[model samples]
Structures are given as C-alpha cells and as structure tokens.
Target: MLSKRIISCLDVRNGKLAKSVKFVDTIDIGDPVVQAKKYYEEGLDELVFYDITASSDKRDIMLDVVSSVAEQVFIPFSVGGGLRTVEDCSRVLLAGAEKINVNSAAVRRPELIREAADAFGSQAVVLSMDVLRVEPRPGLENGYEIVIEGGRRRMGIDAIEWAKRGEELGAGELVINSIDADGTKEGYELTLTRMISEAVSIPIIASGGGGTPEHLYDVLTEGKADAALVASMLHYDEYSIDEIKDYLIGRGLKIRKA
Candidate 1:
C-alpha cells in the first residue's frame, strides 16, 4: 500500500493560529510559525494552513504569515482562503506554498480551477470542500451537500457530483471537511469521506473530527482516504506526530514514518 500521509493543519484567523468546533466558536491557539517549525522538526509528512476567516471576510490571505510559515517548514505546504484567481494562487506559490486550495472562489466560478490548473500544473491546485449532511435531493442523492463561507452558506451542491466536477476541472486532490465533524474530535464522517473518495479518481484527504490515532487509521483505511488532516489533537499537543505514526504502524498501516 502507498504510505498514508499524516498532515497537520493550522487554521489561522487574523494572523493567529486558531481552532474551531463545527466551524464556529473559534479560539486563538498560538503562533503558527512556531507550530509549523515544531511539527516539521518532529518529522511531520505535510502541513496545511488556512486563513479560516478570509473567505467570510472577503479578503486575501496574509502573505507575510504564509511566507513566514513556508520558511519554517520544508515539507509539502498547502495554503487556502481568500484565493480567487490564478494570480492569487501565483502569489501564494511565489510566497512559498507548494499547493493552493480554492473553495468558495472555485464554487463561484469553476473556471478558476481550470485556469489555476492550467497556470500552475494540476498538482498544485487543491479543491477543498466543506460538506454538511442534509436531506437528499435530485443531485444530492447521498444526502450530503456543500457549504461555503466557513460553513455559513449552504451551496446546495451535492458532494459526490462536486468531487467529480472538481477532478474533471483539473483539481489534483480533494480535501473534504465535514461540517458536523469539524472540531468535534469524535471521529471523521467515514461514509461521507468514503463516498467522495470513491467518487473521485484523485486522492482524498479526510478533514475534521480526528481525535485519536484510531480515528486516523479508520479514515485512511475504512474511510478510504489518502490522508488525514488533523488539527485539535495536535494543536493542543494531545499527541505527538511520532506517537500517532507509531500507533498507525502498530495497527499495520503503511505510513510515512515520522
């Protein structure tokens, strides 16, 4: 099996590392730059950074902070939030992020995804979807829908169809953030994740509700995700990257060793 990636996520709000439960009740945590460096040194496989409020606030990401965090880690770094156009993505890549994720902007104009993929190879373009479980509809036969503006706006787009559309539009990967699971640390929405992962040909990174090593394993194996985007458990230092990796290894999962 290809080694599963253990990615640490740093959600920022107004230039400070923050945490949120169900996409609300956000709280400042610490300096993201410090945490980025710390996690890289500890052998993290990858790191994802998000200007969580940028989409809601309708502003660009803080390049200074993105640059600062990029400077701290040499691993694969991805950034998102307030990134709308190809130029915005270019600025971020130039600022040092390896990948640029588009959410609200891409949904507003899907051409942006194709444009970005054309400008900077598809490998650099990530489609991040915030999903919420809802009643089934014609297009959303799965009962899962897409939400934007940090879970404040319901897009009415079906998650499965959206994933396929993102791949067709040249998105290299998909990060599915379950609104109900966000910050819950209970466990991931495995059925939601597995459905999307199987629906798309690209890799799927399961986000939200990651509380323990077992949760990570479940999402990667049974959930059929290619990676696990972790925040709370790591943000509070509840478990070290190495500790998590060791547990996955013991459970017989092929993981990129920390």
Candidate 2:
C-alpha cells in the first residue's frame, strides 16, 4: 500500500489558531505560525491552514499568516478559506502555499476550479468539502449533503455527485471534512469518508473527528482515505506527529517516518 499521510490542520480565526465543535463554540488555540513550526520540526507530512472566518466574513485570506506558516514548514502545505477567483489562487500560491483549496466559492462557481487548474495545474488546486449528514434525497446516492460558509448554510448539493464533479472540474485532491464529526474527537465519519473515497479517483484527505491513532487507522484503511487531516489530536498536544506515525507504522500502515 502507498504511505498514508498525516496532515496537521490549523483553523485560523481572527489571526489565531482555533478549534470548534460541530462548527460552533470555537475556542482560540494559539498562534498558527508557532504551531506550524512546531509540527514541521516534529516531521509532519503536510499542513493545511484555513482562515476559518474568511468565507463567512467575505474577505480575502490572511496571506501574511499563510506566508508565515509556509516559511516555517518545508513540507507541502495547502491553504483554504475565502479563496474565490484564479487571482486569489495565485496570491495564495505566491505567498508560498503549495495548494489552494476552494470550498464555498467552488460550490458557487465550479469554473473557478477549472480556471485555477488551468492556471496552476491540477495538483495545485484542492476541493475542500465541508459535508454533513442530512435527510436522504430520493434520487441521491448518499444521505450526506454539502455544507459551506463555515457550515452555517446547507447547499442541498449531493455529496457524492459533488465529489465526482469536483474531480471532473480539475480538482487534483479532495479534503472531505465531516461537519458532524468536527471536534467530536471520538472518531471520523467513516461511512461518509468511504463513500466519497469510492466515488473519486483523486486522493481524498479525511478530515474532522480525528482524536486517536486508532481513529486514524480506521479512516485511512477501512474508510479508504488517502490521508488523514487532524486538528484536535495534534493541536491539543495529546500526541505528537512522531507518536502518531509510530503508532500507525506499528499497526502495519505504511507511513512516512517522522
């Protein structure tokens, strides 16, 4: 099997790293730059920096923060939140971000994905999906739907169809973030992750609800995810990147040495 990645996630709100449970009750954590440096030194595979309020606030991403974090981490990291146009994508990439993720904006205008891919290659564009389990639609293949704008609005878009469409629109990767599972820390929404993974040919990074090494294993293996995006587990200092990598390796999962 290919080596599964362990990506550290930093959700920035008001220029500080924060954590939220089910998209509410957010708590400030720390400076993202500091955390990024710490995780980089610990040998994290990659990092995902998100301006949590950028989309809802209707403003550009914190490019200064993105640049700071990029300077600290040598590993390829992705930046998301509030990125709309190809110009926005260019700005983030120029700020040292390896990949630009479009969530709400992409849902609103899918051509942005194609434009970004055409301007900066498919590998440089990421489709960051904020998904939630909803009432089953009669014609939909899955019970899940796509939610955007910091999980405050329901798009009524079928998650399965959206994933397929994202790939077709030139998104090189998909970050499947489960809103219901966010900050729960019990485990991931494995069924939801698996559903999207099976529907897309691109790599899928399972995000939200990662609290333990066992949870990571389940999502990466049984859930068929290409990578596991972790927030609470690493942010709270419950485990280090080395520890998570060691645990996964001990469990026979092919992981990059930390």
Candidate models: Cα lDDT each: 0.89, 0.88
State TM-scores per candidate: 0.95, 0.95
Alpha-carbon shift of residue 133 in model 2 (angstroms): 1.0
For 40-62, candidate 2 gives per-residue lDDT tens digits of: 88889899988876444434447
Which lDDT tens digits does candidate 1 get at residues 33-62? 998999999989888888876444433446
Cα lDDT over the full model 1: 0.89
